[model samples]
Target: MSAEIRLPGLPLVALPGVYTPQDDTRLLLRALEREGVRAGSTVLDLGSGTGALAVAAARYGAQVTAVDIAWPAVLSTRLNAWLCRRRVRVHRGDLATALDGRTFDVLVTNPPYVPAPGSRPARAAARAWDAGRDGRLHIDRICDAAPRALRPGGVLLMVHSALCGTPATLARLTSAGLRATAIDRTAVPLGPVLRSRYAWLRREGLLSPAQETEELVIIRAEQR
Candidate 1:
């Protein structure tokens, strides 16, 4: 189950300015499959891009909520979910802010884990992947906020590159009173964003010139 899971070639109607599905998306889907999501399960897709994960979960018969900070991404998610005949509650707000006072059976995220030179992006396409230096910015926030957003026995399945510091993610989730482990891992090439900052990333010791691919890990944390 280490390979990316293709969604049977389902067409996603992604509009301009929305982040399209790619390797990380498939990887997250593979991890989601392992969760054994039951019919009518409540699922949340934080930072939902194009609502691909939401649609996938809906296809599995789960009630899905897809949240993104970008308005265009929200509309794209809504459109794609409708295109797939899957119902998704779409919202545009900072991560988890729009989801207050709600809990879910499962939470899945492929956040902006790419280490960036500065703070999170503002109104740029880079918002999809430009995480702050060391790439734990959103990851830490999720680990902190996820616990309350999950019901007892709830699970979180998050995917990020090894360069962002997997141990930190595991430690954070564990410290947040959840049992955390890397349930799955796979290698993937650097995307355009990472490629653009290759030199800085190398200097920061997150990568090497000889490296062609970075390992992506799915961290599964369960409520205690």
Candidate 2:
């Protein structure tokens, strides 16, 4: 089962399963509009939960491919594409594996980035929020793979936690051969649930107490 969500003039269908769109989807949508991603450009969406970004790109007439590791996400993406009457290729696999031998002019992703404590191993879709020990595991992998996935002069847009591992993300992107820079940032208040979870991490020395404030970073990089 899925639900249809209308974002202003944009209509999107969300999966009833584990995958759902996050605020990062809005950030990417705005960035694409600003950067003028349109027809003919090929866009690859990694960790494409619910297919919002892919559908938006397709709506703009761009060729879009939405990839995820979860089968439910793949099904939802396909359903959403059908509802929109657009052709979006949905692949199910881990990271870049589904995109074998394929490249894109624009690559966008919003990966798992929450730094979970060792005691609390993630379960289900919550795993999508856990980024391993440093909260950069998934992000680093994405950055490392972007060079091969993106064409020369192509663009990569990603949203990650600035408080958790922004510096690490920048370093990883640079080391991965992409000239990365933060383009937009927004501070979102940590809900009580997250605050309590983060408090536990702080007490365990996994996160700094000063990290009570969470910042969302939108990074744009170009393959050089």
Candidate 3:
């Protein structure tokens, strides 16, 4: 499976302690574009990280708002937007809490989908990738909040590892009254976080001995 590449030539700033753009971010951006994130659309990017998606959307002429739980991430996103000469509202909050009562034309996220054995991330940069035991902590929360967060005809493009259960995400969105589908997928080698837990993953039957890669899926849900 092929992965999405970064936006060509957009200057980005990486503040220490912020999550940098990666395969997941690129995949979600591709999916978002395919789903029709165009000029004048109001877009929200959760777990905005380096604000790569936000900046990309702004370049496409969309009004964007990016949110991250970490202050450094929020700061980094703002810097990246400035570097790219695009304007994006950056906020510090958990998930959709910062946008309560606001709806968007599109919602995009490259949330922490790495399934870890801990009850919670250790803090700092770890919070950017370590999802709880099932890896659906943020995914589930996003799904639950989607219908309410989206305006009619709005779309949600989210990327996550398939190990976290793609079907669960689809079901949650569908049950919440949206037309949801897994629109794209790609396989990438285990990163340091996943590699570090390789043994535990094998023991938990989440990964196999010969599997050095993890499959990522982009779930697109449209509010109809």
Candidate 4:
């Protein structure tokens, strides 16, 4: 079944199959709202599945550009924008490549942070969930490109799993000349039982069995 999420004054639909919005998206949206993103600010939503974040930003009066590599995601963003009666630019491509030379005042992203072993290369959910070996593949690229795409003093708010090199992501953003900090965090219950990657990690002694909690980390960074 599909979940319906109401974000303050915005209405958005979550996908029934494949991907869904986690609590981290809500936390990131709240943080962005607090950061004063208004009509004048241009916002970018990376990996914008189902257009929840983009719709929320548009409702708040920001010009939003929603990008996803998958065609389904692009279609979702377009349809959601129509449903909400808001204008959002929807593009399909990898990372910010579809954006060309465009820059934004606010950038929001909920990237794939799952470290799936031996997954297919171009599957939609793989693009949405898997992030290479340590799950930092896409995260690293986003952090590196954000500084260049953001206006000085502009903010990049991102949501990622805490289990996959979160500290390294923070360090990467800092090294890329952006001031980074964790704005919010939440522990979500795991859905997978014994077949989960977490379970395998536990078995391999990589992670403790008590680490079934999925930690969502919200990071806020500003270009220097």
lDDT of each: 0.84, 0.79, 0.85, 0.79
Off by over 4 Å in 3: 1-7
Candidate 2 — what's its lDDT?
0.79
Give candidate 1 regions above 4 Å deviation: 1-9, 119-122
**How does candidate 1 fare on TM-score?**
0.93
Candidate 4 C-alpha error for residue 15, in Å: 5.1
Question: What is candidate 2's lDDT per residue for 60-160, written digit by digit as tens?
Answer: 89999888887777887887788778889888888757568888999988888877767566677676677776677788778888888988899999988
* Number of the candidate with higher lDDT, 1 or 4: 1
lDDT by residue (tens digit), candidate 3, 1-224? 21222456666766777777888887887876676777899999888888889988888899999998888888888888887899899989976575689999999988888888957455888888888888888899899999988999998889999999999999999999999999899999989998899999989888988899999999999999
TM-score per model over all chains: 0.93, 0.90, 0.94, 0.90
TM-score for candidate 2, residues paired by index: 0.90
RMSD of each: 4.0, 2.2, 3.8, 2.3
lDDT score of residue 131 within candidate 4: 71
Query: How well is each residue in 1-224 modelled by candidate 1, as lDDT tens digits?
Result: 11222355556766666777787788888888889887899999999878888888998999998899888788888878877888888988876474689999999998888888865353567778777888887888998988898899999999999998999999999999999999888888877777888899999999988777889899999997
Question: Could you say which candidate leads in lDDT?
Answer: 3
User: Where does candidate 1 have its weakest 10-residue lDDT segment?
Assistant: 1-10
Best by TM-score: 3
Clashing residue pairs found in predicted model 3: none
